[model samples]
Target: MFTDEEFEKYLKELDNPDLSEFEFFTESTGVKVYRRYNKTSGLYDYKTIGGIDVPVDTCFAVYTDLEYRKKWDSYVKELYQFEEDGKKGVYWRVAFPFPLSNRDYVFVRETREFDLNGKHIYVCLGRSAEFKSKKEKSGVVRVNDFLQSMIFTSDGNGTKAFMHYYDNPRGMIPTWLINWAAKSGIPGFLAKMVIACNSYDKYLASKK
Candidate 1:
């Protein structure tokens, strides 16, 4: 069967097709952002927050700690535990828009770039049991898959955050229906993420 991307391309061959997503990556000042949305596309693409930045420890702290996450983002129900990769990561759970739906995700420092001010990248390095809940088996998780990357970079002002979300969850419902719901809901959720990040950025800047 033809993949969604392949079908999209095929349709484009027949006639002009409206792009579901545009400008997969964004750049501003000392920050460059990347993101991807297709279920099977194992890449990162998205927007980055522009303007004054924050410190690496501060930013990472916000992401790794679920309690800290609630101050900034609005989607996490709980963070069960956090463990690092030889002292460079933490594991946690992030809730989705749907009920009893959450993802088992992990975060580990990937690399630090010396250019463009300074850059820090943390990816979803692993997952323990990506289950739907305590009542389910370790079947293919249908909430959020792996391949998500979260990056933080700095500039003369401070540091900017870049979010790279990946995953195409499969479950009882069809992917198309889930994609449709996500298409309708993700923008608002993303807006919340941006707002939370910016608010935290402001709080951090004030501390300096």
Candidate 2:
């Protein structure tokens, strides 16, 4: 735990961050996340799935539970037919009931969840939000259009997460606005992932 002095020092650093401090390093997973404010257009982020310690495999697997999702994850409702690795599935939009609520839970129609042929993204049981995988996507990552791509890499140690949001808004939004949204939203989303690991730990300990 950080002491009061240590916490103050940390806050001071955050206030006037060193650019070098923001630079990405080689994580055990070998995933490179370039964390930065979108100076040009969009935002990029690098963060652990959960703020606390989480083994990667433990993190990814828990991301698939269709029910009991609300216990850890914030802004997603019930999931339907959401495949783990195939390509596509369904999850509802949801809203959290508090300030700084990480997940933006809002239930949407199944049809709304997908495209003309159910060709899109929806939700993840745990890992990260859904999106056009550039390969596959569903609920959270799958916006009405291309929004952000949240990717994960797992090595023996743990997982490294990355996010890249399109710079410009589709309908009427501008690039900076969209980037701001990405910056504002991504951190909390990443931090909330701890719920998954913690919940699993509780489950395992209970079984023992």
Give the range of the ten consecutive residues with the poorest summed lDDT in model 1: 10-19
Flag regions of model 2 displaced more than 4 Å: 1-52, 82-88, 96-143, 147-153, 164-178, 203-208
Write model 2 residue lDDT over 58-176, tens digit each, in one string. Answer: 66556544454656664565445445455454444454333322222112111111122322222221223453423322422323322333333343366544333332223334555
lDDT (CA) per prediction: 0.44, 0.40
The candidate that wins on lDDT is: 1
Candidate 1 residue spans exceeding 4 A from truth: 1-61, 83-91, 94-103, 106-144, 155-161, 181-190, 198-208
RMSD of 2: 15.0
* lDDT for 116 (candidate 2): 21
TM-score of every candidate: 0.47, 0.42
Per-residue lDDT over 35-90 for candidate 1, one digit per residue giving the tens place of the 0 to 100 score: 44554443333433343345555555555555556566655545445333334343
